[model samples]
Target: MDDILKLVEEYIKEKDSKKTWVAGEDWVQYAGPYFTHEEYVRAVKTLLNGWLVLGAEANKFETKFPPLLGKELGLFVNSGSSANLLMLLALTSKRGRNLPKGTKVITPVAGFPTTINPIFQIGFEPVFVDIELDTLNLDLDAVEKACQEHPDAKVITFAHVLGNPPNMDRLMEIVKKYDLILLEDCCDALGSTYDGKKLGSFGEMASCSFYPAHHITTGEGGFVAVKDEQTERIVRSFREWGRGCYCIGKQNLLEKGSCGTRFNCWIPSLPDHVFDHKYVYEEIGYNMKPIELQASLGLVQMEKLEEIGLKRRENYRSLFKAFSKYPEFFHLHTAQPKSDPDWFAFPVTIKDGAPFKRSDICQFFESKMIQTRPYFAGNIMLQPAYEGLHDKDEVISKFPIAHKVTTDTFFLGTSPVINKEKTDYIEYILDCFVAAIRI
Candidate 1:
């Protein structure tokens, strides 16, 4: 093991540590895999211990993730999507403040599918609201309208889209006024702040993804942060095979029948501690726990979060500066007032009269090997997934602003891995695109 570790260390050191910028690279990805030799070693160590499941490492991540979001009670899950699933599941648990079936959840029509998928999967109706063009986040007015239209709305699940927080202060006020449970999807907005408060901390429950593209990478891990103790308990129960027992790990199983009396049992008239932990199910739950190896990687990645934030900020600023020069060609997105965005990607919109279509520009960038992505499922309501789900025939008409964004908006990579050379190359491509279309 020691010899293998040494070889791994040597290999990492021997590799060219300098960052590279290849021209015409297939759309500079939204994020790249980042890790140090130590991170790999920690993962290897966890494997060597023969403890691959959720354990101490998972516990550590769960404990620490909350502070990053300015909250308490972090529960690690298999992926960000799973974290969303668990968050919704917790709300549905009977032990929790059960949101009755068909209860409506107000969400943006422009968000990632997973954010709204759980609401449907949990048998709840989603009240789709439009997003503001400037922030690419939920339009507060539209949200209020949606709530007023649907008084039965039980929750508001909003995402800090692309790391730019919405008007959280106002949104929180609305949530409180309507007595709605606020679930912030911070999957793309970790480290972002609104009015000096972290994005995830404002909601009743918040979720994050540790996918490679996020502020930090854990390969495939995510966490749910809860504000109240009841929510926390429900989240744990949902994650832990719906087991009612809150005890940590294998110790809970051993201490069951070890009381003073030999035949003593915790449950009335039952065998002395013979209850099967695996069979002990309470709330409807799924196995969404993340492995220790992913947690170990998370620990290392967490340490470098501040540095990553800086790089992302710098890259975003550089791209903005480059794109801002041609407002006629593109409509640049802005953060909400008092928002300190840890930009996940630099978003832009092709002007309605611009000589080029979104597809043309995207193809141009692709040909240059620079990657581009549409603003997550542009106007998600337009997708076939929600076609039959909603009552409205023209969902975009309901959310006119979001529809505008869907038609004109797209995003460019501002990931930490993108350096000056890549940014310049991207700028050159954009300039060429504009010239070609103008002619």
Candidate 2:
């Protein structure tokens, strides 16, 4: 073990060392893991311990992550997409609000597909809303109008776009006024806040990602943070293959599992017959649990969030300043009122009548080997997968902002990986693009 540890240390020192980028040869990714020797070691150590399943490491992450979101409980899952689907499942499942198939869910169209896909997958009708042009968040006025128009809508699900939140105060008022269950996709806004409250806390349930592109990385994982224990249990049942037993981690099964009656449980339908609780299936569920190795990586990643958040904010400001000089060409976003975003990117929109279109600047970045991304699935309603399924009139007349984003909006990375050297390089790339346009 000592010999192996010595070799591992050497490997981490060499491989996890600070990276250097060449202007032309290297690609400046829009997002990358801000990892270090510590995360590597923990991942290695987890494997060395032969603890491959969800045990102490997963339990630790579940305990540690929720408070950061101001959530009372959490369910660590396999991926951000799964986390989101579980949030939907927990709220709409038979043991939950249990709304029937074809229930109405109010959601935005200007978000990643996961946020919208689950609504359809779970058999809910989505009422599309346009995003605020600047912040790219769901327009609250429209959301209010949506609530008024669709009073029967039982749930409102939306993402915090590029870590930017809408006006939470007004949003909550709408949530209450309409009695809608709130499900926030905080996959991008891990460290953001509004009115001094964390972004994830404002909703009954929220999801966070730990993918390489997000604020933290656990190879591939995410979390579902719930408002209360009962909500957590429901999500857990859905997450852990719908098992009735709640025992997770190794210690819980040290005896008769966490419930102390693992083998003495009566079947729900056959109360006269008893069986092991661990094998008792409940609701229809999927296996979305994260492994102990990823959880180990997450434990270290959580410790670096404060640092990651600071760099993200710093890079966002720098990019904003760079773009400000070319105001005629770019339309920049303003963080919504009372929002202090741990921003995910520096979003830009090509203003109407601008000399260059979205593709022009995005292509310029690509040529320079600097990363850029078009806004997430722009006007998702127009995506081929959603063809003929949505209201064409809604896309044409009701969602003007959503319509523009599909053509004009794009974004750049604001992750901590954009160090001073990279930020300067990005600025140079932007200046070159603008200079060419001017000529």
Best by TM-score: 2
Total colliding residue pairs, candidate 2 = 0
Candidate 1 local lDDT, 1-439, one digit each (tens)? 8877788777776673754656775457767766778788788877888888888888788788798888988788888998888888888877887778898899988868898889888888888888888888888998898889998898999789899988878888899999998888999998899888888888878899998888888888889998877788788878877765555545445645222232234344565565544355668667788888898889889998888889899999988988988988888888878999999999998877887788888888888888888888877868876687665557856778777777778888878878888888888888887777777
lDDT of 2: 0.87
CA lDDT, every model vs. true structure = 0.82, 0.87
| lDDT of residue 433 for candidate 2 | 85
Score candidate 1 by TM-score against the native: 0.93
Clashing pairs in 2: none
- Residue range 1-439, candidate 2, lDDT tens digits: 6667677778878875655678767988889988767787778888999988898988888999998787978989998999989988886767667877787888888779998898889888898888889889898998999998998899999999988898888899999989999999999999999988998999989999999999999989999999877788888888888987788777465687887777774586787787988788777988998889999899999999999999999999988888999888889998988889999999999999998788988998999999889998988888889899877777856788988888899999998888777888889989988888889
Give one clash count per candidate, in the order shown: 7, 0
Give the Cα-based TM-score of candidate 2 against the true structure.
0.97
